[model samples]
Target chain A: MNSLDELTHELFTFFNGFSSWENSVIKTSELSVSEAHAIEILGTHGQMKMKTLAGHLGVTTGTTTVTVDRLEKKDYARRESVKEDRRIHLITLTQKGQQAFAEHHQYHSNLTEQILSVLSNEENEQLINLLKKINAEAF
Target chain B: MNSLDELTHELFTFFNGFSSWENSVIKTSELSVSEAHAIEILGTHGQMKMKTLAGHLGVTTGTTTVTVDRLEKKDYARRESVKEDRRIHLITLTQKGQQAFAEHHQYHSNLTEQILSVLSNEENEQLINLLKKINAEAF
Candidate 1:
């Protein structure tokens, strides 16, 4: 493979490894990938309405509705009405959902630590800098 | 945040960016995420049996069966009985499936190029080296 192909291969290999780790972590829990993602967003950003959640998830409100329905059925999240507008509902994670999100976050921390263990201090700094630039510009 | 937390945040931010890009790329295609994943695996690894494909996807054989069913119905892939083992069948991508995989690969290359554009040559090398170590040992 050429340089570009080599970079692409390694990039994807890393992404796939992370993806599998994430999927397996979610599999061990009672949440599907989408549900876990919703919980993570709700846990981190506090609470939001359906439209905001949909925007964060890059999915349609219709699809978000189905995911929220499952989350509600499982008691991991709830949609509550505001006093001012009964029609507007904000999605909130239940205690169980919070626990799940915390566990997911812990898993992320552990994975980051694992990744750090394999790199020198200087390499870790490089990685952080590189990711910050890519995250800001590449996407 | 501490150093560990900083690394954790940056790591996940990068992972999420890659995930969103991947999902959007798959969205623009005529395949669902799982279907596109199956096609990519089949196209990249050549024809394989259901069990192998399931192993690669980190999903169950039953789930693989459903995915393959959709692929077959969509005429993107097919299962063929091998001469050596009549009971065992290998999943093969159709021409349409190959085209989708090629498109997906092109998207990956495009993303890689975009990511590369934001970094200096040395930073790119640092990323490749860091990713190599992380991919080899982190997961």
Candidate 2:
């Protein structure tokens, strides 16, 4: 029987390796992982408050502020204050940001295609099911 | 039939959520995710050169340099010059680093226990197999 420590260590190692692989493969353009993630959330959800974006990104509002600042400086995202509530800032991507997000999306597709090319249809279904199960547990 | 773009978007969302969940769960003693990862690699493979460490971290050597600088500043790692080749710098974790690694390992164990609490033995085995299959395709 494997010790709990051994098993957990193996899992952590696997998780880290998987994350590193995804990061390496998906990292293109000038975006950091967090930056790309911020873009992704914006692209999918459309415009959102900084706080909402931060909540989705799982970062503090302060961290989100900093990230947004950098993105804005790069012309990838913009912060627009609501006319009704000036204190609330809405963040949206620029055309350039949308282009970047689209390219990033393509990167993900190519990666998935590469993985799918190696697995049978049954394995693909199994993979998706397993991921859903794990994610459900994670939540 | 799912378009390649749609499939990729789903895959990216799945993995992104997974990564966020894992990050939220992993505990560290004054260590960020990157710092924890670097320490873990050093703990597993003691005394590696800068380039080798960069390769293990799946990051550029310049990035590894910055990570090492932070670790050394925190007294968790130290750099030693190779006698045969003085230009080569080997990075090894300090005793404090090892302690931190142990604590981090415990964090991972706690997380796994939490996850396993919600999974049956069969489900656990299935999850592992599915992850392995997906990872095999990732490379």
Identify the runs in model 2 with alpha carbons over 4 angstroms from their true place.
A1-14, A25-27, B1-14, B25-28, B60-66
Q: List the DockQ of the predictions in order.
A: 0.87, 0.42
What level of docking quality does candidate 2 show? acceptable
Judged by TM-score, which candidate is best?
1
- In candidate 1, the residue pairs with backbone N, CA or C atoms under 3 Å apart (3 or more residues apart, or in different chains) clash, namely none
Q: Total clashing residue pairs per candidate?
A: 0, 0
Residues B12-103, candidate 1: write the lDDT tens digits: 88889999989888878889989999998998899999999999988899999999999999999999999998878899999988998888
Candidate 1 residue spans exceeding 4 A from truth: none
Cα lDDT over the full model 2: 0.77
For each candidate, what is the lDDT?
0.91, 0.77
Find the candidate with the highest DockQ and give its number: 1
User: What C-alpha RMSD does candidate 1 show over the true interface residues after superposing them?
Assistant: 0.8
lDDT of 1 at A67: 100
Error of 1 at A97 (Å): 2.9
Using all chains and alpha carbons, the TM-scores for the candidates as numbered come to 0.93, 0.80
